[model samples]
Target: MVDVFFNTWDNNRINNSRPIDTNDPTYVIVHGYQSTGGNPGNNFTPQAWMSEMAQNIRDLEGNDANILVVDWQDGANTLNYFAAADRVDEVGVEVADYLLGQGVNPANTTLIGHSLGAHIMGEAGEELRERRGEVDRLIGLDPAGPEFEGGWFSRPNSTDYRLDPSDADRVVAFHTSSTLGYDDPLADLDLYINWDDLLQPGASTFVGNHGYAHTLYNDLLDGFGFAQSNGTTLSLSTINGNTAGSVFVDTFTV
Candidate 1:
């Protein structure tokens, strides 16, 4: 089952009350495979990043903002990658159903996901578009490429199966790991971080590189700037702005 947490961002509180302020910008955050919403025992404190990102969003938009964290641990926390991948569309449909039931305004919602969760957001976005309308924005952090892009198993060649520009009004993605993460441009704007070396600075393995997407996003939320080759400093505004197409950014540190 999927566990949705409505975060209040005050003392790590979770308010699951539905029918939140629809006018306020609502964020639905989803984690990737093998991770829970806020379980530390998974050796990866995904909840820590979620909380940090939520707090950062609250700081940017004040207390009126609504933050929802989706945890599909029963389906995602598994040893079988293909099985977990197969459940993406189903879980995404459920997520869409939940959001639609809560009367969330698509124009004021932003879906953020990492790895396999990114594809979940894509499926959810597609379902929402068909049921209601498209979301305002969809942020994909190094979308998983294993089963979807011919690694473990051959996936369908349809763009509908993966994230594309049609998923939302504004689709932005960050490609961090080429091996574990999707290498192709899967959104309106794809930002390739440390593309020259593939491995981000301070990341020893491809897994570390794959996991760094959320950290980079959190850093971007914290007002950290990434520099492009042409001496352009890309910030959160750059991602949210009217920029389109792939841009390369080199990360010098963690």
Candidate 2:
């Protein structure tokens, strides 16, 4: 486990503190392979990024749950995408093993994985399901698509290699980077924020839009009461630019 890093909100470094709290809900966050763990202007180290997200999630849970960050940076740093992708499976199994060893129930866990990490969580969830029979929920934040999507264009190891609806009881996904991300409806709730043009204000590249999934989810955690389309599906182009409050399908009501 030397190469893997797991942190929680109550105890930022779980390795140094008490066992994970099985009584409270658990959140596991996995970052993608395309990260420096550091961002410009923000200077966000991977740990720093997870810490902030943990705090936000804590707020969402009214400061009563466990937020864990699953980091596999050593393997993720590989130059070859295939090599990096192969490493996640072991990590997923290890993460699942740790939770079960800690006596944490999978039904109380919420796995949130981003990009490549999303698929990693799927693997972890699958591992848990195989042994424990089920996992609670999985949220894929713009799962990686380039080399993972199964189709005639590129051969995939398995469609289930990435996040899929079968991994957990509930799967919610936001396809912010449709062009470079999984285009299929892989989540129980597949959300597409502004599917057309794929022009995100932050940048012209796919990453600009990819990063916003975290931002939007963070906002939901922060109690922004993000609205879901009403009955009809939404076609939002820019999260901020759009003011069609009428399209709100649902919101975490206060």
Candidate 3:
């Protein structure tokens, strides 16, 4: 279900105070690997971005959007990475089917996901195209790498259901956590932040690096002086199999 949350409404996704147009550009955000009930990094509970993300995007674009937050809490509540990772495939297809059933325009759709959620969007996009068409974008915020390293579950150039180029028209991956985040360029645009997992400031653990992807995305969208940073833009294909790793590109800015 699309748990629509707005500034006027409590996390319930319904508010009698205002009218939200369904025709607006939609942003469907899915949270990644988590355990239930405020377990800090292991939980998908509302982070700093959740509090103001929808409203902020709406205000920035000057449009009333149908911001759908897919809560796969039940599926993601396990510490078993394999189980949760398997569930991601199901959730991804289900979400894509939901959007199609609602008749949402694929051209205006943008799927934003973090970690496993990021790979979920890839699956969603691929399914959407098979059933409908390609989406505008699939933004991967530090996609998880543990169970997806070309192993039993995911393979780069095969039929495995890991996040790949075929998933969306424009797939963008933000690599903030090197060890945990996907080291390979899994999108049309792969953005490496802070030298690719050198450890984000104030990070007590490796998970902090993953969490910072959300922080960076939110801050960039909110606008800062470095939003228009000019840096060297290089192609991932030129790197050849990512043997070099850490492209050292500037963090993506909105």
Worst 10 residues of 1 by lDDT: 3-12
Best by lDDT: 1
Model 2 error, position 174 (Å): 1.0
Q: What does candidate 1's lDDT look like per residue over 1-254, in tens digits?
A: 54443333432455544347777888988888887774334432346778788778878877777788777777887899878888888778888888898788888899999999899999999999999999999999999988777644565446778778898999999999998888889899999888879578668899999988999999899999876668788799988999899888777732
Full-model lDDT for every candidate: 0.81, 0.68, 0.67
Give residue 41's lDDT in candidate 2 (0 to 100): 25
Could you tell which candidate, 1 or 3, scores higher by TM-score?
Answer: 1
lDDT by residue for model 3 over 2-33, one digit each (tens)? 22221222243323344334487777777788
On a 0 to 1 TM-score scale, where does candidate 1 land against the true structure? 0.90
Of candidates 3 and 1, the better by lDDT: 1
> Where is model 3 poorest over a 10-residue stretch in terms of lDDT?
1-10
Candidate 2 residue-wise lDDT, 50-138, digit = tens: 56677777656765687776667777877787778777678788888888887778888888888888888988898888888577878
Between prediction 2 and prediction 3, the one with superior lDDT is 2
